[model samples]
Target: MDRRRVIIDTDTAGDDTQALVLAALSDRIEVEGLTIVAGNVEFDHEVENAKYTLGLAGKADEVPVHEGIRSPLQKEYETAEYVHGEGGLGGELFPDTGIESADAHAVDYIVETARENPGEVTLVCIGPLTNVAMACKREPDLDELLDEVWVMGGNVNCLGNVTPAAEYNFWVDPDAANVVLRELSTTIVDWGVTVRDSTFGPDTLGRIEDAAEDSEFAAFYDTITQQVRAFNREEMGEDATTQPDSLVVACLIEPDLIEESGEYHVDVDEREGMTRGYTLVDETGVLDEPANARVVESIDAEGFRRLFLDAVIHGDPERSLA
Candidate 1:
């Protein structure tokens, strides 16, 4: 099979950075480009974070990073600074990429690239869906332009990180989320519950640490993930942490790591207040709507741990230092 052409859209913070590195390291997929959106941090920090991540992995020379939407379509943007830290990368500051973010706007780039390679591009979106929705609105036939989309968002059980009924990515931009959930034909959805349950505990982290021993990438990954682990310890009392976005990339690289919930019609609430952004997953055909997605309901946590550690540890950072 041809190397899967992929464009990763992200709000590069703690785990998103890890996801980016994994994609950069994977030989089976070619990263066509990277598009940034505002989510875990502000738009500017997320873009720079992407560049900094690329620099860390030595993939800066390969991927073209593009700036994306700063705010949601109908709401003011909010960030998870407490979880991701003040500077987005767990407060461990790194030098600027020194490479300028690409001149092409994210929405335009998404449109043009997907159009150029029909049924060959996969957008791995790990953040708010603003850029995608905007691009689709611009081109009415955007669905025909791309092959597949894997978006990491929503919660089927209504247990969410940002709010009781919403995940952060969708909560930030329900209007965009709604559009993507309703209109995008080939979307592969990853829910918060599935990712949250399939987490990396102390054992997995120990493996990653041992494998990444003495490498700068390992230290950075360890430090950046500390905040999340600490928070998880305090909240859940078990240091079971997750890089939810990375799971999307892992599923792409090795599909067996994920199990889907078949085709289900999904809807996102766009109204204001508590319930807004909730992903109404109609599992039993209760909504009586056509299916637009194959919802990922479970992941092989152990399988993912092994695959993620293998991919991330073998990157340039680990080998170059040898």
Candidate 2:
């Protein structure tokens, strides 16, 4: 089987780390690079988190990381520090990988990569859409050039996370979300599906803890998830670890994980209001517009948990739990 060439545009926070590790260790994916954008945390911290996470997957020296935009396309910068913590890693301290980001800007790298390998590269965007929108603007045919674009954002005809009507990623940069939704052949792994399928409680955490006894990757994962798990339990009234980014990556790696999906005309609300960044998913075709996105409505919950655990426990050869 030919490995899918992938470029992950991420904010590199807690769950973003899980996504990166999964991608880097996957046999079916050849990660082309990681492009860092501003989101969950500070720009520099996010870049560092990417390098560190790649190191955990034994790809620190191999996969190049490129720094992207520092803020949203047309909004003031916002962060979910309350959810992700100040350092974006649950305040856990790990040894630095001493890896540095590639000198190229993320927008330039994105455009150049797509231009160099048309219809082969898949972009898994797990953050704000600023970098992707700019790349589209820079290369007008980028959407056509890419093999696929999978995004982990939007509420998609459901309630949101950051606000009553918007998910955090889309809320941070609605303009960019609007642009990419309109331009790209995108697939959304939205917030509702994540809350329904990807949230894991103590049983799953116990499994990770068991794996952590032998696997450093699992240990690192357990350590970093401490804060988010607490936040989810205390604040969200959910006793589970939410890893939406990892769920989206799993869907891309194993398509069968998606039990239900549909093509929809999706758009983001850029206007300032309670509905700002709200994802209007045209499920009933009321607007009579062409569908722009394949929205993932549901996924196999047990399959996702297994896939994530398999990666965390035995993905890296040197750090395998067994």
Candidate 3:
């Protein structure tokens, strides 16, 4: 198999942990590194959560973790402890591995990796786009160097998890989101609507829980995502777990699993108001803007479920390494 090389910039909490499980165990991709940023929690906890997560899957040594910018580029640093729970692991604590994040800063790691790998590296931003934007600032040609930039953000489809007009990730750093969408040509973005479209119902949940009995990683995932499961049921009225970040990773591993809404010129509102962090997509040709990113309006839910479950519960370790 022609394995894809990838880097994930993440907030490292809640559903992001479930998403990390998919990356850690995937048989068709090599997760080169994970850069931790502040969003769902603070810098310290997010980094610890990331390390705990990697260690939980026994991939702690294989995939190095990097520390990224804590605050947004321009906005004040905000946290989501209420949503992700303290410590970003749904208030659960896995015994500390005594491991520390890598010495390199996340922005520099991103820049150096993309410069070294060229088009072979896929950078998936599952949190705010701060690290990627900072990398591009340091290397203006970064957009041309990487393979693809898959982002699990935006809210162009009557959706908003954090605000009336913004997705949580984008709302965290709209400035960075704008920078990446405007500069990177190889981008595939997922909107908040993707979460609603990609959830696995009660039966799959039961299967995953049952599989947890045999796999430590699966059981850990089941325990950590409990808050998310309850939140979704209460807020969205569904007994399902929505892993949009995992959907982005699955699509990166296999683009055919999702249908494209077309290449779009997207703009994010970076002000503070009712429309803050809103993503404005150019659907019609009237905008006359060059398409910098492809939008995923819908996906093959079954295909995503299969890819996620297979990776998390039945994947081969050999394929997950470099």
Candidate 4:
């Protein structure tokens, strides 16, 4: 099988770091580049954090990290420092490496790369949809050129993380999210409910820690473990953090892991109200145009976790977390 070429748009939050590690380790998914957007942290901070996380995963030299939009299209950039901590990973620190720049702006790179390889590049976005939205505006035909876009956002029939009707990523940039959900051919991962159902409880964290003792991903695993614990205790008052973005990576590597997906017309509410940034899914199937996305409602949690663990621990010797 041919390797899947992908460009990841992220903010390098704790969970985003896990997804990045998994992608770097996967032999089946070739990460063409990384675009740092402002969501989990400030724009500059996220860029630096992305670089640091890549360095920690031993992929700094291989991946080109780009600075994306600093704020949303029509709203101020919101951050979740309370949940992700100051540095977006519970204050986890990595060695200082020289600041490497992206070869081009994220929007330009997305358009150019996708156009160059029509139907061969997949854009995996795990943060606010700012950069991808900009790309759509710049190229307008990007949706037709790419293979597919996998997004870890929105809530179809479940409670949201930021507000009762909004997930954090969508809440931060509803306008941008709206653009991608409506204009782009997307595969939506309803993390709101799926993540809660596929929780990485204490047992999973313990298993990872125990495995790390003998694996090459020890330091990276240890850092992720600490952040997971902190997110659990500080945010959920629980014992583990739900590996949401890691699940997104799993969807890319093992699409069959999620057996059920429904066609839906998703709309994001951008108006200021109790329902701001809420993703409204038309489950009644009353739309006219071709459904732009397949919203994931369920997942095989064990299969996904195993895939993630294997990817992080054994997939790539050069980028091992040991």
- Each candidate's TM vs. the true structure? 0.93, 0.96, 0.93, 0.92
Q: What tens digits encode model 2's per-residue C-alpha lDDT throughout 1-322?
A: 6888999999989899999988888877899999999899888888888988888788998899999999887788578777777778887655677887799999999999999999999999999999999999999999889999999999976788889899999999999998898789999999999989998888999899899989988998888988888888897786678889999888877888899999989988899888889999999999999999999998999888888888888774223221
**Could you tell which candidate, 1 or 2, scores higher by lDDT?**
2
Give residue 190's lDDT in candidate 3 (0 to 100).
Answer: 59
lDDT for each residue of candidate 4 in 42-131, tens digit (9 for 90 to 100): 677788778877776778988999887888888875687767777776766555578687869888899999889999999999999999
Note the residue pairs that clash in candidate 4. Answer: 216-321, 216-322, 217-321, 217-322, 218-322
In angstroms, give how far residue 4 of model 4 lies from its true place: 0.2
For each of the candidates, give the backbone clash count.
0, 0, 0, 5
Q: Whole-model Cα lDDT per candidate?
A: 0.80, 0.89, 0.80, 0.79
- If both were scored by lDDT, which would come out higher, candidate 2 or candidate 4? 2
lDDT of 1 at 6: 95
TM-score of 1: 0.93
> Which residue pairs show backbone clashes in model 3?
none
Question: How much lDDT does candidate 2 score?
Answer: 0.89
| Model 1 agreement with the true structure over 198-276: per-residue lDDT tens digits | 5778887886678666666676778788788877888879776687887888777777766545788888899999898
The residue pairs that clash in candidate 1, if any, are none
Of candidates 4 and 1, the better by TM-score: 1
Supply candidate 3's per-residue lDDT for 317.
30
